[model samples]
Structure formats: structure tokens, C-alpha cells
Target chain A: MSVRKTAFLALFTTFSLAVFAIEHAIPPLVPIPGIKLGLANVVTLILLRHFRARDAIFVLISRILLSSFLFGQALSLLYSLAGGLLSLCVMAAVMGLLQKKALFLTGAMGGLTHNLGQLAMALAITRTIGVLAYLPFLILSGILTGLFTGLCAGFAGKVLAPFLSDIS
Target chain B: MKKNTAWRKPAVIITAFLLLLSTASLLCLLARREKSDYAAEIFQDGVLIKSVYLNDISQTGTFIIQGENGCVNEIEIRPGSIAIISADCPDKLCVRQGFISDSKLPITCLPNRLVIRLRPVSDSSETTAVPDAVTY
Candidate 1:
């Protein structure tokens, strides 16, 4: 990759990490475990629009690792990593097949996938299947949150379209 | 991107999750409602050290259970509903997980091998906050 690409990826990853860290600091709007605005996802969605899928993957991996280190939660890194990868895969697959207008749908699906992945990891580590009880609540929250993040991504893409095209 | 009336994705996911929750609720309803035993066995080096039950818990704030390794495990029972409030472990996640009240689930700190399981009660009044299974 070119230096510019590397720099862009690094910048995007840092931006995502910042978003993730800040969101964690804020008290959860809902008492549910997986509910969150996931504002950081906007960067990934924007990248998917203007860049390649590989670029978005780079950003996602970097964000998960660096964010985990910053939080000093290395043990929990496995859960986050699995969840992030699954989410990115689902979002990218949906966005690639569906039209740009389905951004909200893609985001919601991504959020649900992410929570499922995390919950799976939790159950595996704890050696128990009891966590499946919260799936309904998590999915409901995911739909709401996914829609919000997707809208944010769409709005950002609209605002940047002209400049993005001009620069390219 | 073009948009269509493809609301099927979210609908399916939501339905699946709701079904799972209902199944859990059903299981909880079927299981006989009994009092919480609150009995916990503190084991170290594959040997049992002490077994403490809720009723016997004194008004004292904290008690230390000596493990075989001479590692004093400090257990703090907060008067009302006795739960393990803290432990010296890398991931304090289990500590923050609060209490367990069902036989199917146990709050475990992997690093410390400390397990806090809900012992089944023989009485008829106590209700478990969660079903005997783990909720996703």
C-alpha cells in the first residue's frame, strides 16, 4: 500500500478507537449489555463507500486491538475481536450486494451480529448456555442502535460526497 | 445505493431472539419455585476449604477464607442479598457480575478459579432472578 493509504488507514483506525473509548466512558443509555450508539461505526461505513473492503477490515482490526490495549482489558480482547470481525463481514457483505440505500439495514444487521458473536464468546468462556436468554433484548436494542449508526453513516457520506469525488 | 422494502432481515432476527427469551421464561416457570440456599463452597488446589451458607453470614463486613496455597480469599457479603462484591483478579468482570440465584448458572472468575453458583433451595418462597439457564 502507498504511504497515503497507510496514513489514511491509520487515521481512520485512530478515529474509530477514539469513538469506541468515548462511548464506553458515557453511561449506557440502556441497562442492557450490548446496547450502544456505536458512533465509531460511521468511519467504517464511510470507508466501505469510498474505499475497498480490505481497507475497512484494516481499520476494524486496528481499532479493536488498540482500544482493547487502552482499556487494559486484554483478556476480553478475544470477545471483541470475534465480534468485530463478524460484524464487519456481515456489514460488508450486505453493503456489497444491496444498494447504498440499505445502509440502515446493513448497520442493524451488523449490530445484531456483533452482539451475537460477543454473547457466544461469553457463553463459551463461561461454559454455560444460559446467556441465550438475553438474545431477544440484545437484538431489539441492536435494531434501534444499528439504525441510528447507519443513518449517521449515510449523512456523513452525503456531506462528503462532493469533496470525496473531487479529491479522487 | 437503491432501497427496497426488505424489512425481512431485522424482523427475522428479532423474532428468533424473542423466541429464545420466551423459552427461557417458560423454563423458569416450570421449575419449582424454592428458597435460595446461598451455600457456596470455596475450593483451592482441588480441595474444599469451607462451605458458607447465607443464614450463617454474620453482620461483620468481610471474612477471609484461607486457601491451601495460603492465599487468603477475602469475601465481602453486603448485608441484604449476600453476593461476592470483589475479588483480586485480573478481570474484575465476574466481580461486577453481581450475584447468582439459580442452579444452572455460576459466576466464575477464570483467573482465580473461584465459582459462585446458586444453590437450589428446598423451601417454597424464594424466586430466582434469572432462569436456571444462561441468557444470551
Candidate 2:
């Protein structure tokens, strides 16, 4: 990768890590296990739009690993890894198939898959299928939060596009 | 780049479908209430450790469950509601989940491999109630 691209990714990684840490520090909005704003996803969506899937994946993995090391536990690390990877795959596919006009929908899809992935991990570890009842609640919250984050990314992309083109 | 409205149509349809599905599931969850004759079963490592009849219980009590790797969860049982009051798990998700009175949702401590589920009592003449589902 070019030095400029590497440096840009490093900057994005830092921004993502900061967002993750801040979100974690804030008290949960609800008592649900897998509900969160997922603000860092805005960065991922932006990266996927402006760059390549490979670059977005690198930044995402880095942010997950670094944030987990700094502020989360081993078990949470596993959950985040599973959720992040699944969400990334879904978002990448949506991006490729639908293009940028449907970025918000991609975000909603990512959120849904992310919750499913985490629920699957929870079911595996606890060995309980009854936990599947939480699926609907998770999906509801995922759609709302994902839409919010997706809109934020869309706005951020609009504001940064001109400056980014100048830099490149 | 050309501004296109084609993607909006599909996005709207998908979002509407998801909304409908979520609403239906929410209604089902809210409508399905277990009868008071249910029993709360505690499982550790997928093994039945304890079962308490919700109707029979007259007193509220808290008990500690020790699981693999020194994991501990303090479960609180009332006349009808059951909940995890405290736990050594990192996320404390089980604790944050509060209490449950129905069979629809099971409170689980994933890291500790502990599960608490409410199941309806069978009316058969058989004295022992066979588990409807095996967790593990």
C-alpha cells in the first residue's frame, strides 16, 4: 500500500477506536445485551465507499482488537470479532451489489447480521436455544441504530469528499 | 455521478418487510404469557442442577451458583419472577437482563455456561416431568 493510504487507514483506525471507547464508556441506553449505537460503523461505511473492502476490513479488525484490549474482556472480544466480521461481510456484499445510493440499507443489513452473529455466539456458549427469543428485539434495535449510523456516514462522506479528492 | 432514485424503491420495500416482521414478533412475545403453574429450572454446563415450582414457592430467596472456572452467579427467585441479581461474568449481561416470568425467554450467562428457563408443567399422570428441550 502507498504511504499516504497507510497513514489514512491509521487515522481512520484511531477515529474508530475512539468512537468505540466513547460508546463503551457511556451507559447503555437500554437493558438489552446487544444494543448499542455502533457509531464506529460510520467509519467502516465511509471507508468502504471511498476505498476498498480490504482497507475497511483492516481498519475494522484493528479497531476491534485494540478496543477489546483496552476496554473489554476476552469473551467480549470473541463476541465483537464474530459480530464485526459478519457485519463487515454483509456490508461489503451490499456495497458491491447495491452501490452507494443504498448505503443506509447496507448499514441496516449489517446491523441485523451483527446481532444475529452475536446471538449465535451466545447460544453456542450457553448451550440454550431459548435465547433465540431475543432475536426480534435485537433486530428492532439494530435497524434503528444502523439507520442512524448510516445517515451519519452519508453526511460525513458528503462533507469530506471534496477535501479527500484534493488530498489524493 | 448521476443521482438515481431506483435504489430507494427496494430499500423502502425491505425496510417495510423488516418492520412488519419485528412488529409481529413483538406481538407474539408479548401475547404468549406462561401460566402460573410453571417451574424454573437452572442448568449448569447443560446439566439440570435445580428446579423450583413457581406456584409452590412462598418465600423469596437468593442462591449462588458456582460454574466452571470459578464463575459465580447469584440468582434471585421470587413467587413468580426469577432473575440473576449478580454475576462474576465480565459483561454482566445476565444481571442487566433483570427478571423473567414467562417461558418465552431464558436468562443466560454465556461465559459461565449457566441458563435459567421456565417451562410449563405437564398434566400427564406421570410423576416426573420430562424436559421439553435439552439445552446443550
Candidate 3:
């Protein structure tokens, strides 16, 4: 990659991390542990389309890991890892298969997958299927959050379209 | 041609998740009907602060009791009789969790450094729900 591309990637990655860190600083809108506005994923969806999936994956993992450390919650790292990996898989699959016009749908799926994966992991670690009781609430939030972030990403994609039009 | 098919993924996943959640809820309700004596310990900083039975609280009633430390924890015993009610915690996430009786969910108060947990009937070998392990 050229220096300009590398510089852009670094700056983008840092910007993404800043969004993640800042969102974490805000108290959760709901007292539920897993729900959040997921403001940072808007950046990820944008990166996924503009940059390579590998780079987007890198940014996602790096941000989650670093954010977990900063929060001083090592136990949380497991949930984050599970949620991030699942989200990346689904998002990349959908984004790769669908056209640019459908990017918002893919982003929505990513959000849903992220929440589902986290809830599944929480259930496993806690050794109780009772945690599954929260699945509906999480899924409902996932849909709403997904739509909001997807729209945000949709606009971000539009803004970056000119520069990224030729990447593929 | 394939336009609407894309929507199928989330639709399927969400439906499946909802079904599973309902199943879990039903199972919890069934389990609650069983007659079992449960001992829950509310521990604060390794000290046993409170102990209560699972069957002690009815479906609709306040489990609120002041501990010796003079802290009030509002426990709600409902269908899912989860014990951690209201706490002095800044987060108050535990308070909003509602009643959880399913033995799977534990009530946690971050501010008070307290955790209310349910142990299975067999594990309730101790005569008192509160263990002798911690200093009051």
C-alpha cells in the first residue's frame, strides 16, 4: 500500500477508536448490560465498504480489545470477542454478497449478530439458559440501534463514495 | 428478483431468538412451580449480610429488608424471584433487573459491593442461608 493509503487507514482507525472510547464513556441508555447506542459501529460499517474487509476486521478487533483493557474489565473481553467476531463474519458476508445500495441492511445484520453473540456467550459463561430471557429485549434494541447506525453508515458511505468508488 | 430475500435473514434470526426467549421464560415458570427450599446469600465484601429462602417471598411482595449495616435493598420476588432489588449503587443496573427467581440470575449492587446469589437445593446444606464463612 502507498504511504497515503496507510496514513488514511491509521487516521481512520484512530478515529474509529476514539468513537468507541467516547461511546463507552457515556452511561448505557438502558440499565441492561449489553444495550448501547453502538455509535462506533457506524464507523466500522463505513470502513468495511471503503476499505478492505481485512482492514475493517483489524480495526474492529483492535478497538474492542483496547477498549476492554481501558475499561479494566478483562471478563468482558470474552463477550466482546464473541460479539465482534460474529458481527464481522455476518457483516462481511452480507456486504460482500450485496450491492452498495444494500449496505444498510448488512449493517443492521451486523448489529443483530453482535448482540446475539454476546447474549449467547453470557448464557454459556453463566451456565444458565435463563440469561436467554433477555434475548428479546436485546434483539429489539438491536433492530432499532441497527437502523440508526446503519443510516449513519449509509451517509458515511455516501461521503466516502467518490474516493472509494474505484477501490473494488 | 432476489430483492426481498435479503430481508429473510434478520426476520428468521429475530423470530428464532424470540421463540427461544419464550421457551426459556416458560421453563423458568415451570421451575418456579416446583417445591424447593433455596438459600440465597447476599454478600458484601466477603461478609454474609443476608440470607433468605427461595420460597420465602411470594410472587407479588416486597423482599425489602434492612441489613445490619443499615443499608436498604429492595428485593422483588416475582415469577422470576431474583433478589437484588434497589441498591445505593450509582449504576443501579441490578435494581432495574426486576425479580429473578430462576437460580440463574444473581442480583448485584455495584455501589454497595453486594451480590445476592441463589444456590441449588442440594447446595443449601447449611442450616442458615447466610454462611459462617464471612465476618459480620
Candidate 4:
């Protein structure tokens, strides 16, 4: 890979790690177990749009792995991996179909699928189906947070469009 | 730009639909209530370790369950609710979940491999309700 591309990936990875750390430091807005702003996702959405899916996935995996190592427990790593991969797949597919115009939609889809993926992991690890009860509440939170991050991503994409084109 | 606008219309419609569906589901979930006569079953590593009937309990009681790898959890049982008051797990998600009175969800400590679930006490007429069937 080119030095410039490598540098870009490193920079993006750092940005995402910072966002993840900051979000983690803040007390949860609601007492709900898996609810969060998912602010780092804005970076993921941006990377997915501005660069190739391969690059976006790399940044995502690196961010999750690094963040878990720094500020999370072993159990959290499992949940993050499941949620992160599911959301990434959903957002990429949605963006691929709808293009950049539907960035917010992609975000929302990612949010919902991310929660579902976590819940599935929770159910499996806990060995009880009762955890499914959190589905509705999780979905609602996912939609709201997803929409917020998606819009942020859309705005960021628009503002960075000219500069990003130069790098590519 | 023109193509973007066309996609935006469908996107908006889809978002609105999801919002409505989730809202309706949320309301339904909130409104659904579990029967008061039920039993709380505690499980460790997918094995049934203990069962307590909430209706028969009159006083609060607490017990500790130690799992593999030295993981410990303090489970509290009350008249009509059950919860994990404290745990040695790193996340303490089960403790934060607080008390649960219904069968809707269980308190789980993933690191400890501990699960506390409520199962409705079946009467003779309600025998048709499969105990193992996962509803919702």
C-alpha cells in the first residue's frame, strides 16, 4: 500500500479509537445495558463511503480490538465483535445499494443489526431465551442513535468530500 | 444529485416504517405483564442449580454462587422479585439490571456463567403452555 493510504488508515483508526474511548468514559445516558451513541460509527461510515470496503473493515476491526484491550473486559470483546461485524455488514450492504445519499439509512440499519447481534451473543452466552425481552427497547434505541450517527456521517462526508477526493 | 434525491424518498419511507413498527412493538412489550405466581430459576453453566417460588417467599434472602474460575455472584430473592445484588464479574451487568418481577427477561452474569430466569407456575388448566417453548 502507498504511504499516503497507510497514513490515512492510521489517522482514521486513531480518530475512531479516541471517539470510542471518550464515549466509554461518559456514563451511560440510560441504564440500558447495550445502549450508546456509537459515535465512532461516524468514522466507520465515513471510511466506508470515502474509501474501499476493505479499508473500512480494517479500521473497524482494529478499533474494536484495540479499544477492548485498553478499556473493556473479555466478555465485552465478544459482544463488540458480534455487534461490530453485523453492523458493518448491514451498513456496507445498505450503502452499496442506496449509495451515499442514503447514508443516514445505512446508519440506522447498522444500529439495529448491531443491537440484534449483541443480543444474540448475550442469549447464547447466558444460555437463556429470556434475554429476547430486550429486543423492542434495543431496536428503539438503535433507530434513534443510528439516525443521529448517520446524519453526523452524512455531514462529515459532505464537508470532507473535496479533501478526501484529493487523497484518493 | 438527482439520483440521490430519488433514493432519499425511499429511504425516508423505510425509516418512517421502521420507526412506526418499533414504536408499536415497544408499546406491546411494555404492556405485557407476567403472572404474579411464578418461580425464579437460577442456572449455572446451563444447568438448573436452584428454583424458588416467589409466591411462597415472605422474607428477603441472599445467597452466593461460586462458579468455575473463582467467579462469585450474590443473588437476592424477595417476596416477588429476584436480582443479583452484587457480583465479582467485571461488567456487573446483572447487578445493574436490578430486580425483575416478571418473566420477560432474566438477569445474566456472562463472565460467571450465571443466569436467573423466571418461569410461570403452571396450574392444571394452563398445562397446555409448554414450559420449554420460548415465547417472544
Show the colliding residue pairs in model 3. Answer: B80-B101, B81-B100, B81-B101, B82-B99, B82-B100, B82-B101
**What RMSD does model 4 have?**
8.1
Query: What docking grade applies to model 2?
Result: incorrect
DockQ winner between candidates 2 and 4: 4
Please give, for residues B35-84, the per-residue lDDT of candidate 4 as tens digits. 54878889999999999999899999999999998999998899989999
Scored on chain A only, each candidate's TM-score is 0.91, 0.95, 0.91, 0.97
Could you give candidate 2's per-residue lDDT for residues A1-168 as a string of tens digits? 878878989999999999888888888666557889899999999988888889989999999888878887657777888888899998888776665776787888788778888888878876866667678778887777888888898899999888666433
lDDT score of residue A96 within candidate 4: 74
Error of 1 at B12 (Å): 12
Range of the 10 consecutive residues with the lowest summed lDDT in candidate 1 chain A? A28-37
Error of 4 at A154 (Å): 1.5
Task: Give the distance in Å from residue A152's predicted Cα in candidate 3 to where it truly belongs.
Answer: 0.6
> Order of all candidates by DockQ, from best down to worst?
4, 2, 3, 1
Q: Give per-residue CA lDDT, model 3, range A1-168, as digits (tens).
A: 767776776777788778877877786565456888787888788888778788787777777777777773646778888887898888877776664445666767788888999888877876765666567667666766876888899988888789876643
Which structure among the candidates has the greatest DockQ? 4
Candidate 2 share of real interface contacts = 0.21
Ten-residue region with minimum lDDT total, candidate 4 chain B: B127-136
Write out the backbone clash pairs for model 2.
Answer: none
- TM-score of candidate 3 on Cα atoms, chains taken together: 0.61
Model 2 bad stretches (over 4 Å): A166-168, B1-6, B33-136
Q: If both were scored by lDDT, which would come out higher, candidate 1 or candidate 2?
A: 2
Q: Could you tell me how far off, in angstroms, the CA of residue B75 lies in candidate 4 after the best superposition?
A: 19
